[model samples]
Target: MNFEDFIISPRSFKTESWQIGSRISKGIKEGSIVLLFVSDYRGVGGDAEMQDFTGVRKEFYKLSQLDFEVPVIDLGDLVSGKTVEDSHYILQEVLSACHYKNAVPVIIGGSNDFAFSLFSALNFHQKNINYTQISNIISLKQGESINEQTFLSKILGSKNFSIKNYHHLGYQKHLNETDSIKLIKEVQFDIVRLAEMMNSTEKTEPFFRKADLVTVNCDAVESFNDPFSMNPQVNGLNKREICAYMKEIGLSDNLQSVGIFNYNIYSDNQLNHQLLAQMLWYLIEGINIQRSHPKERHYEMFYVLIDDTEYAFRRDVFSNLWFFGKDENIENCIPCSRKDFDEAKKGWLNPRLMKI
Candidate 1:
């Protein structure tokens, strides 16, 4: 597939420019980080509203590359196909290309439906995929045609799709339907409420750890001086907290694909532009900061006999991270916080250990 044919280069930023172009050219030598923006919002299932991804892309490219060492490439904005499905196919092709090149694809999209395309593109790489999403609303509405609201359901119900684990973060209770929220727990999939996340960001890190793909709905962020997303929420994660989570998404050991969806690009707000750009920057920074583990370290193992069942725990002394399960590696072990580890010492059944 000729990716250049399907993507349009972004316009220059009004803010002060930096050495981003030079850095990206240099970074593409090894494993590069590629940016692909999708500006079509037709699948949002309303009057077609044209969105501008270039606003965010322009701001992203202008940011100073202070400590950025990773090879980066801007594939530029994706030209929407005649139909939404057409766009999905094109996106899948592009993502697959990036995957083959060992380039991490960071997509800024018009709607969350793009996530479905991302998952489809990623299907060939692995079985039993570990997927994580940060969104404000849990819309499982099964519509006649695929839309932003029904996309999640389509993914979950698809016969070909293989989902190992799905972790949802930053969901507000009021915005979500009672039964839809109930179903999350009834199915045993992880769902963290907005209140829980605001209380502690550390607890949510485990959800992103070793994740294959991560997607964030921009609507999950609270609107500040300007609206942060197309579907703006009056209450949600603040700018700092959302960016912090983005960094964590980049820190994943098995990180492959990312999409920041539901952003309100129709508005002419500099604050929104800056916010999204910085979010991307932090994510890239986190990727750069990731400690590549070529060498295996000895994990200190601890055992707790709960109801005559021996539940094991492991700790990586170097990273100061804890895990629940028998194996030591993050992939093999269930990611757990220090609190989960501490509970095991007192014979408490570690919730994280049980599910895996």
Candidate 2:
């Protein structure tokens, strides 16, 4: 069967952008992993004609030629009908298929709303799924419209899913509405402010550890940095900085999947596409690194032979190697018990590097 037959473009513009045939051929030759590439038409409307996919198709074909194998699947046509609920159902079907096949889903949509169906799918498959989502907007008030402010809000407003496992990263003061802030706090999200995210790397570490699935909305990049995104902002991180965080987080051995959304062609210049491609490259590179270096090392226990004291104490090394203890005090070297020790071993740690 033809692999391109499975490819669905939501709009003429998206089809025009793809290089499907060559991409499919190269993907097959490379024995690449299956990756769903959902492309959407801009605006809220009915099904549109499948236009010529020359520009974007060439890019996908070129990307398929990389040494790594990646079979490109499409779900752009699933969002049919006038209701947002229809788009939601289409997203669910696409993601459910990905989940069944153990494939990664890469969605490029008209707005951040593309994530709602995926979110709903996770909700449906709640027993077997875990989500780690990141968005700039904090919440969607009851009557908010689908313009620039309410994109993330709509997802937030959707009722079926629980926000207990959600992680809201890079929230800006100016962009979020007052009601959104209240709702975010009410939902108990681990909010990592844009300033705090940039202030220190260690401080932002918790957000990365919270999930198996990670979603990045392109608008998270600073307005100046990613002019092409739907709603760019002055306070957000730049493309390089955001991509670095993605790389570092993707290095985590626990990540199951990832998605990038809201990359409107009309929003920016040609530079946006290049930036998006680079960000994706970072993600793929990060996953490759994690796959190669699967094992995470830690000092299980230190058999310190204290000759002067005439005792060979088996002190359990609870923390990672980098732990220098809380401050410069030797008292912090208290022996760790089994329960506490297991939690400390979550990430890689080097000797002489411990902090609060």
Candidate 3:
């Protein structure tokens, strides 16, 4: 439950990814906050040799430079030779215990697959708990009935889960498996495709609205963002675009937790570590913006219809609640405030459409 428990030194593991920082340690604690869960879980296997979580831990050190007090709990090792499901259950118990005292859990992970454990820990039992997933690839390989990346498939295929309220960003065209895309569409995940992000003028602001947790995957940001990554995809979003997206998402009114995963320190050069640091700073910037937004308010905007009909409405931008007159064409329209307009109209909002 202490900061010392969260960090692992490079010398502890004879692997490529764990070499950047001599010792991986948690950020400095200044807040009364209790537990923050972070770990280097690659020791178990599969892409273990390929993962380098050291850069992210380096980011944690930089975070320490800032003025804050929150202990980061490091869970030393991922249970070896166990299925992803087993890890999920194990982390679920740990996280539930950590959150019991209102502690914010920030997880540092080896792969996008790590999210399965974090999500399982979160439980998503309450309607108020909104989840947001950020990844360059959809990570939904449903047809691979017995594949390593079957976490998403299992979650969506299960009858017990109610995942209708989640949002997914950075879905690349070729990175997604066909069946995965089909499954994603069927599940109604709000996808902001790489093409759409590149082509559109807006950053993915709308998707982050009211989210309770933000899960980030380093692979989602092209290989350039993390040179240490072995399987970096060329078509991924650039560092700048990824930062902007994270900033917008972090600034959302309802976001309470944030996570960064899939960083491979082994493949990284000095440049990659620097980029990782910058990305972490941007993530914090997003949190700062959310804290600075104006207080909650119910406001109305009027628009004239082609038939000259006037619509009167009231909306809570901060919470995304809405009410309108019966005569208004509100069927396809949900209630939103000027906050929505501001977000939708932001200049650097969407980056999936970029030429890169």
Q: How far does residue 117 in candidate 2 sit from its true spot (Å)?
A: 1.1
lDDT of 3 by residue, 145-216 (tens): 333266566655656555535677777777777777776667565676776566442545656766766787
Q: What's model 1's lDDT at 187?
A: 85
Best by lDDT: 1
- Model 2: lDDT equals 0.50
The per-residue C-alpha lDDT of model 2 at residue 226 equals 35
- Choose the strongest candidate by TM-score: 1
| RMSD score of candidate 2 (Å) | 9.1
Tens-place lDDT per residue, model 2, 1-356, is: 23234455433323222333343422222222334444353322322223332333334434423443345433333333344544445556666666566555555544566665556655565433335555677656444344334445655556755644556777787777787777766766456677866744455554564355677776677665436555655666776787787775566445655667655445334456656666665666566555565253334333222223221112324323222233233323422233233334543332112222
lDDT of 3 at 304: 25
Model 2 weakest lDDT span, ten residues long: 304-313
- Model 2 spans > 4 angstroms off: 1-6, 9-82, 126-130, 143-164, 199-202, 224-226, 295-356
lDDT of 1: 0.81
**C-alpha RMSD for every candidate:** 2.5, 9.1, 7.9
Worst 10 residues of 3 by lDDT: 347-356
